[model samples]
Target: MSDKMIHAYSGDEIDVHWDKRLCIHISECVQADDPLFEVGREPWCVPDEVAKAEVREVCERCPSGALSYVDKDGTPEQPASENTGQVVYNGPLYLSGELDIEGAPEDMPGVRFRAALCRCGASKNKPFCDNSHIAAGFEDFGAIGQSGPGLDPGSAASDGPLKIKAIPDGPLKMEGRLTLKAASGRSAWQGTKTALCRCGASKNKPFCDASHRAIGFKSD
Candidate 1:
């Protein structure tokens, strides 16, 4: 027990459950190759292609907890058997037991792994980024008046939740817990922490789907 942790990366393989507190903003996870570290996206890693040992080695090499094993969900059960007991189902991804991500030995220790991030900007799911606003275009202004399975955008602000803003003509800018509602059908998602679109321009329906990219979405 060195009392210190390490975080390592090699090519496009891991998301590196980042610990902003312990991390110095090193660009390793943000720099690695493709499919493994899509940067600005969830599942940041493609572990199958990369080896756990190699990842461990990289972590061992880091002076910071940047690559530390805050939680090993993306990995397998056998390899990270110790982590199995800590696994907690989180709908989209598995949450490892309270391990440690940013703690410098005494702070609230915990690790986060294989998380679904918010690409759409509408995520009532805190820390968890659901790709909703993206699927819906979610204009900045549009976010002002919308309802989802577990959220009512018009009123979420009063709850001290994240706020939404149109990027001028760009994708909606959501900065807090967001929820999404059914764009159609018999309301499959009854009540779940999610995010939907306001722009109503997402090809993925209620989600943003990044169609804004093709449709020339800008918020300037």
Candidate 2:
């Protein structure tokens, strides 16, 4: 297991794990009425402060895949039934389903469910968003534009692994089925393969416009 992984809280029924490296501070865990996560507390996250169901709900809502939990007897966290990539307005790409992120660290112990990937080309953490888009003043309305040539209808009846390859100084090469959507929850694209922009210079927004080459964006 990764030394950086935080075993935040554990109890007879559940255990909470936090990956600091992946957190972008979306604040979902701290917004509940009872508030399982308190900023000033020594442990910060006290699963005992709330019910197991509430803890799991908040953790599942973490788009960055930073928070996860294990249950002793109840149903555990599972991968999404369908693969999806949701474009966040002026922010990262939120991906869910069975994901196989190329070069991602595998030492952390948790259920692999989701990830927030960089789109602004300014993240110190390449491929993963570190919320650098806000500082960089990256602006994208997160609207749907061109779509990939889709597969036969019902081809995606079952969830499959979505492979994301972060190309050096280029785009995120996605392989396997994906249902890409805009921030408004509208379908943007449906396909098995596509190259998404990491460089903020893409005129096509979510899709690569070869702007990485012109802007000399470096992923390393």
| Model 1 spans with C-alpha error above 4 angstroms | 1-16, 33-35, 70-103, 106-220
Summarize candidate 2's per-residue lDDT along 1-220 as a digit string, tens digits: 5565555688567788888878899988787667688889878888887888888888888889889888878687888888899999999999988888988876443325789999999999888999999999999989987676875556763236888899999999998888999989998798888899999999987999899998889898
What is the alpha-carbon lDDT for the whole of candidate 2? Answer: 0.84
What is the Cα-based TM-score of model 1? 0.25
Predicted structure 1: lDDT: 0.36
> Candidate 2, which segments miss by more than 4 Å at Cα?
1-7, 109-111, 151-159
- The superposed Cα distance between candidate 2 and the true structure at residue 12, in angstroms, equals 1.6
Candidate 1 has its poorest 10 consecutive residues by lDDT at 81-90
User: Per-prediction TM-score, please?
Assistant: 0.25, 0.90
Give the Cα error of residue 11 in candidate 1, in Å: 17
Range of the 10 consecutive residues with the lowest summed lDDT in candidate 2: 151-160
Tens digits of per-residue lDDT, candidate 1, 1-220, equal: 2324433333454434444434433355546543444665554554545566655444433323334543254652122211111111121212222222221234312222212223333444322334344555544321212334453546543243233343444443444333332222122322223333323356543445566666664432
Q: Relative to the unseen true structure, what is the C-alpha lDDT of residue 6 in candidate 2, on a scale of 0 to 100?
A: 57
